[model samples]
Target: MKQELLSLILPSRNEAEGLRRLLPELVTLLPDAEIIVVNDGSDDNTLAACTEFPVRVISHPYPKGNGAAVKSGARAANGDVLIFMDADGQHKPEDIPALLEKFKEGYDMVVGARQSGSHAGAHRAVANDVFSRLATWMTGQPVEDLTSGFRVVKANKFRTFLYLLPNGFSYPTTITMSFFRAGFSVAYLPIHTPRRATGKSHIRPTRDGLRFLLIIFKIGTLYSPLKLFLPISLIFFFSGLSYYLFTFVTQHRFTNMSALLLTTSMLVFLIGLISEQITMLIYKDSD
Candidate 1:
């Protein structure tokens, strides 16, 4: 296989202690790879600790979310392949080679799927499972871990998604769906994720979870608006049709409510159709 340079992109927020251990392991494991750590508004000594390491540090004066950090790292990367991993120490640097090996198989992207039971808490595990199932349904592929930060992707292919990414924690969803929508090959490699060595998780279940839902909806609409919108529109249309049919069969006339329902249903479907066309045009132009 031809040798290719890899850029390891780590998105961190106040993870000084984790990086202390992670940086050394990464350096030993991926000696030839360039590591870029995006410090997402750390108040601690996160940046200070990284100064002694052989890694490039990109600091965000104020906290931008993980997605923003990943975007910055990607923009600054100088390698043919990009590997994104969390700086919280949950992801193992030793698994980097497995992801890189998958890239050698001509796949556009390779995701590291955390083994079941590796998550820190039960609630988080459930949330991860739900998101993974939703993603699988959207892509019509078995997505084991929709939220794993440990992933390897071809840099050029990933560049196409920079504009669509959110600045928060939902980047994995957008990137996974984008690859499937654009007809790029994506493969999953199962790996175990250990608990973070230090620092609390940045995610707030209530706030980030809702934001995550919105991100999923946005990506769903962009990739297959018709698939998402059409079903809901059809339900509305059918309910209206049923009411109208009932009125016609019983009294030979449509009531005001039935007429209004039918009108709204038609409008909903029409809007979906228009949105689908616009989405296709935008995707085409991007290509």
Candidate 2:
């Protein structure tokens, strides 16, 4: 079989120094692959730094956000397979080949799952675990790293979700769930990221952390609304049943609270049933 064209996309903002060292390594390591860098309005010499390199550089007028930069890069990439990695000097260049090899194994997407202790902060680690668990339950597939930026995906498949992709840092979470819900095959490979070698991380855990949770719930609802609704419905239904039994034993009658809880449970289940049907209609042929 003929080899597919590969495109390596790096989204940067104030990563001039890191790009100075990383870009050359990419050029030397993967000479034939197309390398494109999208500068997200870095005030530093990010654009000038790429002038000396042989990479195609595209600069935004102002800061658009990391996810926006990724969409810009994906739109410009002309490869059968596209690989995205951070320009913050976290992802290792050597891991690129492994991701490509996994892609060749008939997987539509391959995510670089970071090992434990790979996070820069303790809270970030806890937050990532929560996202992963939520994603795993929502998709019915084990998601090792739902928020990892280092991933390989088929360009054609990835492009389909561009419109749905958020213009923020939660792009990874959105795409990962979308792929799984669309019935695309996804695999995870253990990868270890080093501490930043340049500027500090742009992510504000307390701020972006809330955004991540919202993105997770948004994608979960978009893909599988029933997965979330059904569990809550069951909780309310059982709680109401237990309460009703207790009231019957104590006062020989069912209380209004039990009736309200039971009614809410039925309403929630009805919503989940309707949502399940809508989800099927929406994603019928999306794959």
Candidate 3:
């Protein structure tokens, strides 16, 4: 396919300056793209900034989060292909072509994995690495960047998981995991990002960091509960055995702690077994 109907969706909030700068570059790069800017209740001139461009603008009455804006863009997009990128100026417009090119090779989704120097800060880089590692373990595939907000995906496949996405900052993580769990083909392309040119970053290490971690556990269970539960169950079981052995040699009797550990392990194993069954039924229609 030489040409694809591409829709570029930018989810923005209080980013009028960034939009003013980015929209023109995007228009010049992909003249025919159906560019859509989702103004997520910005107090600034976000809506006004988009008026001078050829793109369509959607405005929210109140401040909905990033995830909510993405859902709106996905639902309103008319193209077969959807390209989602932040309007905070961190993502480069030039990377869109590379992502689309990767998508053309028959990938369901292609994420723009940010290079090490591209992260907003060193702490953020380390945190993202940790999240990526955990996601890779959960999916049993190398997940380069789980929370990257820049990527291109087939609209049909991408819309299927809209209901699974939370109206929060972690929509990227949710959609990425949902794709993997549904057996969709996913690929990553390394890209560099410059720091945002306008507005302060909303990412606070103490707040958003915990949110990302919670998403990991929630998505981990959604993917495979046993992968998360089995390890804790084993630890309990082994601890009980070791304690029982020590008690038998020292006091010649089974101790309360040993029995408690064994009982808890059995209960945890049962719970995990039930969760696995439920998870299987939940995703039975994935194929």
Candidate 4:
């Protein structure tokens, strides 16, 4: 086979300094594996810097997004297993073995779960906690980290959801939830990350936080719309019922507000039902 058994994908954007330091070490360690550096429209000499290494560079002409870079790397990779890590060196090269080891135990994907204090900032840490809890409830499985980019996945299985991944930083969230909801085995290995080696983080708390919130909403709608819609429908129904009961007892009449509330409740429930069916049909051919 032309492809190696494993491939390493590093998504980079103006990370020449980190890539220069990282590539040589990765070359020494995983000599046989195919190394792909997806240079996501770096204004710096990221492409030029990678020339000394044997790794492949998938260069984009203009800036797309982190997830877009990842998608490019994934499509270009020719391996049975794919390992994804940051090009900025937040993820450790030494942890690669641990991810591979855990994955060999039959997991479709193995994530490098970030330990306490490994988070980039307090706000992101808290946000990740909330996202993890929500994902755990939705999947009925423990979600140690919902946004860890350090992971090794069976290439075939991962490519199945390529279309679902957005062209943004939220790809990690989408893919993780997709695996859980699709009944694929996933494992997490604890790891600590040092501060980034190079390049400034593009993640702004206000902006990316809102984008991730949108990711959560997309996850709800994509995997199981009913999980999101049913609870909301029930809340509206109960509120409407309470309002109707209060008016019936106090005024001996069904108020227009009560009627509107009750109607809205039923409408939401019907929408949830239809969404659930559509979600099922969409994944019917799923492997």
In terms of lDDT, the best-performing candidate is 2
lDDT of 4 by residue, 1-287 (tens): 45438999999999999999999989999999999999888999898899989999998999899999999999999999999999888998999988888988989999999999894788888878888888888877889999999999999989988998988998999899888777889999999999988889978888776797786777687668888888888888888899999999999999898888888888988987898898777666568
Q: What does candidate 3's lDDT look like per residue over 148-190, in tens digits?
A: 9999999998888788788888888888888888899999999
Residue 204 local lDDT, model 1: 85
**Per-model TM values vs. the true structure:** 0.92, 0.94, 0.94, 0.96
Candidate with the greatest TM-score versus the true structure: 4
Residue range 202-250, candidate 1, lDDT tens digits:
8888777678657657656757777776777778778888998998999
lDDT accuracy of residue 83 in candidate 4: 97
Residue 275, candidate 2: C-alpha displacement in angstroms: 2.9
> Where does the lowest 10-residue lDDT sum fall in candidate 3?
278-287
- Name the weakest run of 10 consecutive residues (lDDT summed) in model 2: 212-221
TM-score of 3: 0.94
Compared with the true structure, what per-residue lDDT tens digits does model 2 show for residues 1-287? 88889899999999999999899899998999999999998999998999989999989999999999999999999999999999988999999999888878999999999997674688778878888988888877899988899999999999988987888888998888888888999999999998888988888877776786686667667678888888899999999999999999999998999999999999998998898898777667676
Off by over 4 Å in 3: 1-3
| Model 2, total clashes | 0
What number of backbone clashes does candidate 1 have, counting pairs of residues 3 or more apart or in separate chains?
A: 0
Give the C-alpha lDDT of model 4: 0.88
What is the lDDT, from 0 to 100, of the residue 79 in candidate 2?
95
